[model samples]
Target: MPKSIVVPEGTSKPIAPFSPGTLADGVVYVSGTLPFDRNNDVVHVGDAAAQTRHVLETIKTVIETAGGSMEDVTMNHIFLTDWANYAAVNSVYAEYFPGDKPARYCILCGLVKPEALIEIATVAHIGRP
Candidate 1:
């Protein structure tokens, strides 16, 4: 099946050659999102919780633009620049995904942007059983 790109309004232009999200066969594949402003500069500086919230909001926008919701998310790949921010990340994550959380894995690694403490890519199925 053919795929379509999903780019929500107000989303920052990607720094690289990739769409923010792609819709294929009822699934929305969201690109790894960072806490960056429209200018592509990292936000929230040293705060992990704020960064997580920003990333999730960006993901939400892409998913919704692709006709899906956070509830439809099936999996997530979470990346953190420091393990010290794990708990902070989790706290903000829980706020977005209240119950029946999606399957996810978190890793500690350096991000493309040093000031970006967290990045999350998501996969969600829409209108599929």
Candidate 2:
């Protein structure tokens, strides 16, 4: 049977109907994470770059909780309200994966939260043979 994992409470969330992660077939699927902090409040005030960093940090925590590291992330889906901020987000993203870059797709979309300019989710491979 596939096992589901719930990310710890203190971390950020999806802002609506979703768990942070689920582990199945040795692959961890993380939900899209916004810039929300431990208090469930938006962390980045007026900066998309800050918001991007915040979301990635939350994604990192989710990955770790699933017995995986950032390096284990095989794929990522990045949602952005504005593609113009790609460079802003990419700059911060580059810092996280310096050596091995995961396959990813970035798309521009409307976010349910007003303050969120970006959200990130990932699929990771864990429990290697």
Candidate 3:
């Protein structure tokens, strides 16, 4: 059986009923991350591009905390409140994964939180040492 572990960072607390990140077998799965800042506040209020950046940055930090880097990411699932914001989200996303981008899926959906225009979840592999 694979053991499951949670990602740890003492700076901010999780406000929802979810683990920040989980380790199972040799892979790390990070939960859908919102555009919350270090203080756990939604930082990007008016811009979808800014919100996308925040979501990606948060996912990157969670992956790194699990001993993985953005380069190690296998897949990403992106959720946007509106499809019209695709270009804006894509532009910001390209900045983070500059080369060898991971496979990704983008979907337009109604968000649980109104101010959040974007959310990103990631899967990464921490290969055997």
Best model per lDDT: 1
lDDT of 3 at 43: 79
TM-score of each: 0.97, 0.89, 0.89
lDDT of each: 0.93, 0.83, 0.83
Model 1, span 57-86: residue lDDT tens: 999999999988999999999999899999
Q: Candidate 3 residues 84-118, lDDT tens each? A: 88999999989988999999999988776788888
RMSD of each: 1.3, 1.9, 1.7
Clashes of each: 0, 0, 0
What are the runs in model 2 whose C-alpha is more than 4 Å off? Answer: 12-14
Error of 1 at 67 (Å): 0.8
CA shift of 32, model 1, Å: 0.5
Question: What clash pairs does model 1 have?
Answer: none
lDDT of 3 at 129: 28
